[model samples]
Target chain A: MFTGLCAFPLTPFKDEQFDPVAFARIINNLTDAKVDAICAMGSTGLYPYLNNDERRTVAENAVALADGIPVMAGIGALRTRDVLHNADIVQRAGVNAVLLAPMSYHHLHDEEVYALYEKVTANLSVPLCVYENPNATNFTFSDELYQAISRLPNVAAVKIPGMPFGDKVQGEQRLARLRELVPDSLSIGVSADKFGVAGMRAGCDAWHSVLAGLFPKTVQCLIQAVRDGQGESAAMASDRLSPIWQLFVQSKGGLRVMATAADILGVCEGNCLPHPLKPLTGPARQELEAQLTSLQLD
Target chain B: MFTGLCAFPLTPFKDEQFDPVAFARIINNLTDAKVDAICAMGSTGLYPYLNNDERRTVAENAVALADGIPVMAGIGALRTRDVLHNADIVQRAGVNAVLLAPMSYHHLHDEEVYALYEKVTANLSVPLCVYENPNATNFTFSDELYQAISRLPNVAAVKIPGMPFGDKVQGEQRLARLRELVPDSLSIGVSADKFGVAGMRAGCDAWHSVLAGLFPKTVQCLIQAVRDGQGESAAMASDRLSPIWQLFVQSKGGLRVMATAADILGVCEGNCLPHPLKPLTGPARQELEAQLTSLQLD
Candidate 1:
């Protein structure tokens, strides 16, 4: 159920409230492109910022509008109870899978993390994706922890941070080590959009992508080039968006940059991110617009 | 309002529901101890696990039971909107201050964190404590960022993680460096129960202590020793509790160990920590029980 390009669209906001119209526009772009899957309420969707009701609204809409594409929604939270609550919400909304990051307030131990997945998976009706997002959650999973969690019921995939930037050999070695630990049934997905193609080329099963969320065709072409074993073509396709990747780094992850690009491209409002997360400003905003215009992908 | 020993009691639960009776029992103990202030709903209270309604329940109960001692409630959340919402709830519940951590799903920039404090403080009716707890929040603050945030309205204090373990000179140096950056009005408090004394001896104005949460007299004596300039007495007091400190190290932080001690002493139920945060078990639990018995802390 978890394979290929998993596009993550922003849960668009206007005037500090959810703008379902703008969200449908984003989801429709993914459906029209026929991306492998659409993952709503992922970190790129600002899952943590929204309350359960808002999350349910996004989940129901994403599943409804994906035009028969499989949908996954992030159900990660600080508590097992809330995670279970979110799992029920997304599952009731008919999402095909749920992504759970062991989000924490106190840093979790390996055993505690294992217990979390064990408890969560026991209650889940859908396949569960282990979201190993250390940057956001402060919980890094060791190979031992991964092996333990992947063996749990309904475990589908593990979404890891993108490999060391541009280091294909290092990426392959890391993937190789992880591959040895988990069963073949548990898919290994990669995030961190800048080096996503490197991870895909290194044999990651899916690119759980932020880039694909905004520019579906662009990322799809790159992934397709790789699937066809056209290495140089894949590299060339990835290279075409180097300027945007640089902006992702400059802006610190894709959330702010994606919102800015979406705003500049007229896909969403001028300042779409939830409060405390401002859209790009001044030189950063100008550079993104200039780069987006040059790419001409919109 | 933030000064001296601000005890943080666990919001004890039973049968998967908040045991307000157990909560009040813990609170009454602190009120009887006359700790300088009481901080309910800090990390030790598992603020992240509870919903706003639950948090409000805890806040209201904490204030009602604190007997005239000032109360501070944690209002930190992933979104600024919710932080404000929590701020409103706790303020209405009559907490003297709110503790705001720049809790993140997306790792925040210095500017973003500043914006969060600025926005939150703008709506706050009570003073705000900057909770610079990197271990849980995964967002570290630069000294320059500290300087910027400390200038905001209602910014009362900064609760830092404990100083480097057993390194008094280093603790003092770190505090000195920080002292130069923030206003004198912002009381600097320290957490990490094992090193609470080191932080206090090094000139921290308060200990936002997990140890004080459960064993108020034990921790208060140590602080009182420091206030009297009896360095040897303070060190001796800390050393006497080395067994529990070792347990704190073994358990990663004071939460599990403290919960175990509370259970063994019959202050709360046997498995009192929220679900997914299991109580200490097997040899760890046995060892803690033996150590507590030997210490005759009960």
Candidate 2:
């Protein structure tokens, strides 16, 4: 009975240090929005940037903030050992589930991909959500591979990044096929909150939202509209949310954008994306400000 | 002065675990061949499959085995954090240098690529080698990016896969230009031990060998012939080694093939490549055996 929006919390950093206080405030804000589940240390949460200890701390804090709502921990890496290590940390922290990307440098055949899921499921005590973020992983699970993995024990759901901006039709077709393949008990989650209404109309079970981390009420309203078959209201909310998504996506890197948005919303004091990603460009910030105003989000 | 042959030790695994004893023995065998230096845990060592602790152990054992000879640790990953973590571990283990690959993701612009090297170099205490293994990384460092990274304080060298295998003249020309752009102190290392004599003739400072992990003596002999300016002897040695190289290349996945050959050489007890690479086929074994016999490597 998972309804409403799921928040993918941004991990806060101050002067290259993990800011638990700032992170706590961000998670507390998401809880105030009443997000159904909190997804911690995912791509949006900058999972890859954090060390094992940092990841454990973030997972524990996120679970505490949710106050009994499920906290799905993202625990995938190029190496299986590292993934296992992360899973152990999350499981010990008592998270609800593990979200994993089947990512590796080696070209994975279908059997290899299946084996990865089988191995992870065998080791993990918590329910697992197989994340199908092909852009990050560089490998897409075949429909056949997905079907096999979904049948594995403790695999509670599938997280699909529903159609990016242009590939709506293909994305919709994939979602439909996935829905038919997965059993009725297993949920199908969409990270494309902007298209949550369209994806829900196409048969998605859950809306996993990055935007919900910032604007929980608006996203919850949009989700409620979709659940209640109020397509017009849902579409209107999505239109208002589109500008914010565009602003974040244009800010060089996803983590930086997420942290900046968190800062702007007053959820966190300052944004600190680790090294390599520079601070926002002048034009990019101006564009972000204009978009926020246009959507009446400021 | 590093030149001629560079041996990458077989990362020994016992009971499906990283065995420092077996690794030390393999390193000892290479040292006996008077190999220039050991590139520990590079691609040939199955870098992607090893965990941080395993990587650290391998580096420490490599240093101990080298016994005053240089040990260059391979530190490459899709995530910048993992790469930095591995670099710090290797540096602490007292390896002479670090070898790095570009970030493993698609559509990475030149600036992003440059930033990766810059960040890694800033933290690394030892010398660094910029690895350009396009076959593995999928992303090739441009001459412009390579030139910029080569100028960093700790960047001592650049490793490029030897002469374009597919007769891509443009690639060869680019390599030639890259050689010109890199500082003279920054040595250019080449892979492809079979035609390494040719690579030496083409102006590379040293030949990086995966096959050397299997037959260090044969590889050392070939490199010595090349260094001594005995072209005919070097060509003869290459001809003798060609069959083994073909077998190594033909054994299923490229890295797996090398690992399997390492198994046969008793360098590592059986091949245990992580998910995605299956064991070698029956025909591959037959081919490997015949090639080993023909090369009189038995």
For all candidates in order, state the fraction of native interface contacts they contain. 0.62, 0.27
For all the predictions, what are the DockQ values? 0.63, 0.30
Off by over 4 Å in 1: A164-166, B164-166, B296-298
Quote the positional error of residue A13 for candidate 1 in Å. Answer: 1.5
Question: Weakest 10 consecutive residues, lDDT, candidate 2 chain B?
Answer: B163-172
Model 1 residue A237 CA deviation in Å: 3.6
Q: For candidate 2, write residues B77-165 as lDDT tens digits.
A: 75566788889899999998888977553334467678888888999888988888765666777778877989988998877877552
Best by lDDT: 1
Candidate 2 has an lDDT of 0.73
In the predicted model 1, the residue pairs found to clash are none
Q: Pick out the ten consecutive residues of candidate 1 chain B with the lowest summed lDDT.
A: B289-298
Distance from true location, Cα of A245 in model 1, Å: 3.0
